[model samples]
Target: MTNVFEAQWEASQVEAMEALRAWAVAFAELNQQMSSWLDLPTTDANALGQVLWADSSGDPLSPARLGQRIGMTSGSVTVLVDRLEAAGLLARSREHSDRRRVTLRPTPAARERARAFLEESSAEIAAAVQGSSAAELATSTAFIRKMAAAASGATTRLRAARS
Candidate 1:
């Protein structure tokens, strides 16, 4: 039964997939809630999140790069940035060498609010995973990293196929 299940049923794989789907839904809900709480459009909240993440990572993200990451058009990104800047959630600065090049900067107030929004979920996740051994956590990290890469490649292939 084990061999047949492994070969034909994909065994417990479907259960794992169901869990992953639920996790994905939870993440989407988090984004939706964050957007609502911020009184911002989902797209704008996503853009601000990207800017905050980049700034925290010590890498300044440009509008073009953020648009590319979020699959938004240049014109749409321009409009989004304008709206965010107007909302005091973000600021833009021109590159010293290339005055035409604009980079996103998250306001401290916005970053603090974003972190506050995420804190409860972060704490929950930490508590849930706290029982994992070092080796178990390492294995989970590797699995998730590989899954992310595979998912990214699948998205690229799907986009190309659509094109």
Candidate 2:
């Protein structure tokens, strides 16, 4: 039996979580459209994004690593890698100490195209936030970060449960 104020707070929390979920789905749809701009499906688009992120982070990319990042299976990753390689978007090598560990990279042209597309989207986002107060932006950023952490924890728990 919760008090009235506690119940109200819980309700508000639920509403905020729902809004977060909706925002995530909308963002994914936008990303899908961006992928279409590259003439690639959502899976490949996500995989490409992960590869680019790894590269930007100065971390090496590989098919196995990408599959883990994108919630894809080993076979699916292999085929996805094959298709991207065939499309001239992905470059593969074996420079790692472990000869069996294949490294992945995005082609310069593909990376450039993705960068251009995202720049346009980011400019739109910047414009959308133009009138927002600094405090508002900080609050929004904090909320998003908190929600992201919770969601990531949920994913790990669910994956472990499945295993």
Candidate 3:
């Protein structure tokens, strides 16, 4: 009893979901490759990536903030930070107004390694999307952000339900 418009909308939704799933798979593969190239486990690489992103955004992460972002315990974060620091991939400094707070930053070597590994792929991705109209690209960006928000909200709800 569905109308033609409803059917078409449903088809579009299905296609969007499939594309999102494919994107997730591709992202995981990229993470795996990066991890291997860095000679670090996936979790460590992910934490490093978070630190790099936060630093690049001009808000470097404290250990506690990094733990919250990565869903790790404070003790676990300490261990991870120690490991990364020992490997010379990360550095911790008390640069905040409150000297007690330690900020995490990726070392130059880590940044160079990541840039070397990702520059080509990043450029290719930009090239692939360059043909899209500005409006189309904006719409796609908004759609991805909406999808991410929905997924994150669902995760929060599920965690709350468990608690």
List TM-scores for all candidates, in order: 0.82, 0.78, 0.87
The 0-to-1 C-alpha lDDT of every candidate, in the order given, reads 0.85, 0.86, 0.90
Between prediction 1 and prediction 3, the one with superior TM-score is 3
Off by over 4 Å in 1: 1-9, 129-131
Q: Candidate 1, TM-score vs. the true structure?
A: 0.82
- Give the top-scoring candidate (TM-score): 3
Winner of 1 and 2 under TM-score? 1
Top candidate on lDDT is 3
Tens-place lDDT per residue, model 2, 111-151, is: 89889888877776777688789999999999899877987
| Residue pairs with backbone atoms closer than 3 Å in model 2 (clashes) | none
The C-alpha stretches of model 3 lying farther than 4 A from their native spots are 1-9
lDDT of 3 by residue, 1-163 (tens): 5665455467778899899999899988988888998899998998999999999999999999999888898999999999999999999999979999899999999999888888755776787699789999999999999998988897889889999
Candidate 1 colliding pairs: none
Per-residue lDDT of model 1, residues 31-95, tens digit only: 88889878898988888888998989988899899987788989999999999999888999886
In model 2, state the lDDT of residue 119: 80
Which ten residues in a row are the worst by lDDT in model 2?
1-10
